[model samples]
Target: MSDAAELGAFLKARRAALDPADLGLPPGISHRRVKGLRREELAQLAGISVDYYTRLEQGRAKNVSDAILDALARALRLDPGEESYLHNLAAPKRREKPAPRRVRPELQQLLDAIQAPAFVFGRYLDVLAWNALGGAVAFAFAELEERNIAKLSFLGDRGKELYPEWDAVSREVVANLRTEGGKHPGDPEFARLVDELSRGSAEFRALWAEHAVREKAQGWKVLRNPVVGELRLRYETLRLPDDPDQGLVVYHAEPGSESERALGLLASWIAADERPVNTRSPHPHAG
Candidate 1:
């Protein structure tokens, strides 16, 4: 979608998610007719006119001021990530042509050196690179043809079994994808992935429609591995400043927990195998 169109959809979604009763906006038949606060209510809260707000939502407004965007963000109760997304949709920069991302040799060395589960995700959440233990703990990155993380999360390789908290994990995956999609409006690869998932999974379609933008940083990840049963670990997502399209996700368990021992066992399994796939995991940007 165009940035302006997306800007409008985002405004509508956020407005639909709020409650007039909580804000004491004098609920009545209109409140019941619509799901959330009326457009006029939101415009009043943001100190804008109803006509102007409607224009903004219809993608008809141009050269919007930062003050207006800020007010809208505050009125919508957007989180930092969502707020950033809102700004991107309001004022987009030059579009970069979709290009394939490659994990540098040194970066791959770093992944191999780390004793934890570490892998790299590309612009569309493709598993671009991973160490031995990383592959073992998660899905075998070497075994898959399409290593896109979002696709695996929703459609392939018994991923639901791999992620015990499937519902939360899947929702967060869609949100992250949404954030990426917003950054590069009209990206064909993103459109392909979205179309594919929307056709394959009903739940994914519902979450995608919600327009909730999220970027994963650091969090507790639980995995139910066929090899090691339930393995709980902490994960950190590190983005490369030079290559904004790539991010490294590293996972570790607590020092003395069974989860740590599970990592050790996975390490042993990885050490025994010699999968000669390209560890850099070079994949073409979705066509």
Candidate 2:
């Protein structure tokens, strides 16, 4: 969608979600035609002309002032994230497709060195690189066809099983994807991902229509690992400043907890499997 269309759709969706009683407006006797606040009522509350508000909703308004956007956000009862998303939709910046992601050798080494599960994610949440533990403990990096977190969360069932708090995590993933979508408006790959997911998953379609935005960051997750049973893990995401679109996410279990013990067992098992075999004969005289 064009920026104007996106802006208009977002305005309409937010307006439709509000209730007159919730906003302390009297429930009138007349049957209302619109679902929520009428355009004129919203304009009156926002201290703007009805015609101006109409034009804004109809994608005809240009050079929208911050004052108006702020007022509308207030009138619509938007949260900080929602307000920021609204602003982005109103004034979008075009972004070129990012170059193909390549994990530096040093960064790959860093992932290998970490005792905990760690992986690198590119702009679209593609699993660019991961250590053995990351692949074993979390979702299988090599198993995924697209290696995209959003796809796994919505289009597949792996995320539902992996994350105990699946609903919240799925929403966050969608919101993060939405934020990325706003940042790169006409990106073909991004648009294709959205289209594919929207068609493949009803949940994705519903959430995508809401126009939520969020930045992916550190969070705790309860994972149901087939080998380890249930484990509570804290994850931290560190963005590469040199390449802002790339981030390294590491998952750690709390020290001395059952989860930590499970991780230790996993580490031991992996180490044993990777141990080199002694090939040379000991001595000619040895029995």
Candidate 3:
């Protein structure tokens, strides 16, 4: 449950998930004993001694300097998001307590100003807030438990129906959640979410076992909008510089495209619908 154990488990799990072929390692003749890369292979790729890597995995060594962390990150071919997770795992504890639950005020302003479908999410992919257009685009929000992205993506029955490419989105969500779990294995909320989803959705359980991890950035999604039928929108995860742990997810479409037209239609629908009273308290970081 300690941070070090969480970091070690994440590294090991990610390493085990990688196929030798994925990393350009030769496929040995004998049937592989482990699922992913072995300790020796990972050590070779990382330019570290196998003994050292083993110690790190065992959580027996506490000398994880920046150099070693960087080396391991590169060996795994981690993207910027995963690399950030690695650094956060190794960071020293702060003296002050972390902020309580809620979206920051500045983030709220940023979300409100955007005309496109957009929402802010916490480190755990919890929906902090969404703009009017964003809410309109995802009407499934009403059925979702607290508008948590992970919960909606996995547990919400309407979620699968709402997404055009339900299976692919489910896998991606589970993969990202797995990645977060590795980085913060001891996080109570993370554990609770994983447990809830795993029990609720068979699809989530299968994807979780695949050991996939993905950065939540720009991607395309075909959403089945109740107002406009189906719209293929491009979504981007905008990382917040000051907060570091939160990001604004903005969805847009190419000009004059069907997607754009659909978005406009959704906007009109939102304007017509009765506005729900905002009950969410202000997040501490809200400036």
Candidate 4:
């Protein structure tokens, strides 16, 4: 979608996500046609004219001021991430960045040194690199059609089994993608991926339409690994200052717990293989 269209769609989605009663709004009409706040109600709340808000919703308003954006944001109760996404949509055309072609030797070493499963993700959520444990614990990476986290979560055959908490995990993936989509509105890769996923799964289409924006920095995941049974692991994202486009995600279990012992056994099973896993890519970019 064009920036104007995306801006309008985002506004509509957010407006629909709100509750009228939450803001002390009465049921003004017995046969109210719209969900959430009506156009007049939102305009009144934002201190804007109803006609102007209508224009904004229709993508007819141009050169949208920060003041207006701020007012709408407040009225909609947008969080920091959503507000930023709104701003980005209004002022689209942020430049596309080139992805790194190869992980640094030091970076690859860092992943290998980690005791637990670890992997690096590119800007578009492609699996750029993964340690041996990551390979064993998470997926058979090389054999997969696409190394993208979004595709893996939604489109892959094993996605549901891999993530026992499928709904939450899948939403997280979509939210993270939405956050990226907001920042780099001009990115073709982002558009292509969204189109593919939306076409493939009705769930993906529904979640993508939510316009939820989030940066998943840290979280707990219950992964059902085939080798070691269920792994209740806590994952942390380490953003590289030198390369902001790439990040290392490490997943570890609590010390001395059954999950931890299972991880140890998993690691041992990984080490037992005479052939070392291919943890680094000659060409780092996935697409």
Candidate 5:
């Protein structure tokens, strides 16, 4: 979709999600055609003219001011991520073509040094690099034919089996993808990933249509690992400052918990498997 169309859709979806009663508006006796606040009602709430708001929603208004955007955001009660997404859709910055993603040597070293499960992800949540435990604890990073997380979460059955909170995590993944799509509207790879997932998965199609925006940060997840059984881990995502398109995700369990013991067992298994590694030339494997 074009930026204008996306902006309009986002505005329409958010507007429809609100209730008049929540915004201190009385429910009229007349039958309402729309589900949420009317255009005029939202305009009044945002301190803007009805005509101006209409034009904005219809993608006719160009060069919207920050003040008006902030007003609209407040009127819609958007969270920080959603508000930022709105601003991007409304007035996106011109972007140059993105380069092919590569894991930095330093990042690879950091992943190797970390005792916990750690992996680096690039655009579209591609597994750029992962340590031994990362591959063992979660899905095998080396085995995935399609390394993109969205494709794995929606299209791959293993993802559903792996994540105990699969439904919630899948929705969050879609939201984060939506945020990335808005930021890089011109990226063909990102666009292709969305198109492929939407075509392959009905659930993905339904969720993507909602246009939710989110940032993947700290979160707790329960995974049914084949080796460790049920492992509950807290994950933290750290974005590579120099490379905004990449993030390092590390998973840890609380001290002396069952999950912690499970992690320790996983580490031991990985260590035992790697003990007989040859010092000769390493075989190249696609991630």
Candidate 6:
């Protein structure tokens, strides 16, 4: 399918997956004809005409003002990440600005200095670079033949083992991708990745249908550390000051905690088994 057509399908599908109750709409009967908020319902929430919203979803709307876009975003109850995605879709020209070549060197150096595990990632969640500790915490990076997170989550058995909550992780991954895909509808690489995963995994198909989006800013992670059994670590996502698309994702554990010891052991194991690689080497950057 054409890129624009594919994007339209993706946006529509995601919109359909959201329930009216999610947006605080009164509970409609289960026998309602549609699964999610109806087109008119969404229009009412956005304080726009149904015709206008329909045109946008149909990929026929033009000159979508920022105010209108913001209204739509608010009506959709989009998170900051998802709201950005919506704006990108309305104005495809913005994404033409290339992401910066290197994340600030200071940022990279800082990530390296952190004794704990950390990695800096671009907007697409491309793995620009990571410290030795970072590699140790998420062992899947070393094992990844491709660095793209979506591909790994859906296509590889290793991801299943690495992500303790595989189902939840997969859903978030798909949702995030849905937001990205909406923003860069014409991005060939993004389309190709989605097609490859959709064709390869049924689990992907189901989650893709749910149409959720998330910013991978900060969260708790439970990983099956190959070296340290299982460790539950808290990760904070720090957005680089200059690079909006790139951020340092650092993992840490509470002090005097077993997870902390496991992290140290995992670091030692990485030091022993894997050579420290460049932060910019060709690796799939998946968020």
Candidate 1: regions farther than 4 A off: 24-31, 273-278, 284-287
Put down candidate 3 lDDT per residue, 137-233, tens digits, no spaces.
8754433346667777777687788887888888888776665555554566676777888899887878776556677778898888877888999
Clashing pairs in 6: 125-285, 126-285, 127-285, 129-279, 147-284, 148-284, 149-286, 175-212
Cα lDDT computed for each candidate against the true fold: 0.84, 0.80, 0.74, 0.84, 0.82, 0.70
Candidate 3 local lDDT, residue 7: 72
Residue 280 CA error for candidate 4 (Å)?
0.9
User: Model 2: how large is the Cα RMSD against the reference?
Assistant: 8.5
**What's each prediction's TM-score?**
0.92, 0.82, 0.80, 0.92, 0.91, 0.81
lDDT, candidate 5, 1-287, per-residue tens:
76777788898889988988888897562377878888898999999999999988887888889999999999999999899888888875587666436676777778888999888777677777888788778877666555677877898697799888988988888998998777676677777888999899999999998888888888999999998799999999998899887889999999999999999988888777846422111113232
TM-score of 1: 0.92
Q: What does candidate 2's lDDT look like per residue over 53-142, in tens digits?
A: 998888888879899999999999988867877787777466675645677778878988787888887767777888878877877665
Candidate 2 at 213: error in angstroms? 2.2
Q: Write the number of the candidate with greater TM-score, choosing between 1 and 3.
A: 1
Q: Alpha-carbon error at 236 in model 6, in Å?
A: 1.2
Candidate 4: clashing pairs of residues: none
Candidate 2 structure, TM-score to reference = 0.82
Quality of model 4 by C-alpha lDDT: 0.84
Tens-digit per-residue lDDT, 172-256, candidate 4: 9999888877777777877888999999988899998887888868999999999889999999998889987778899999988
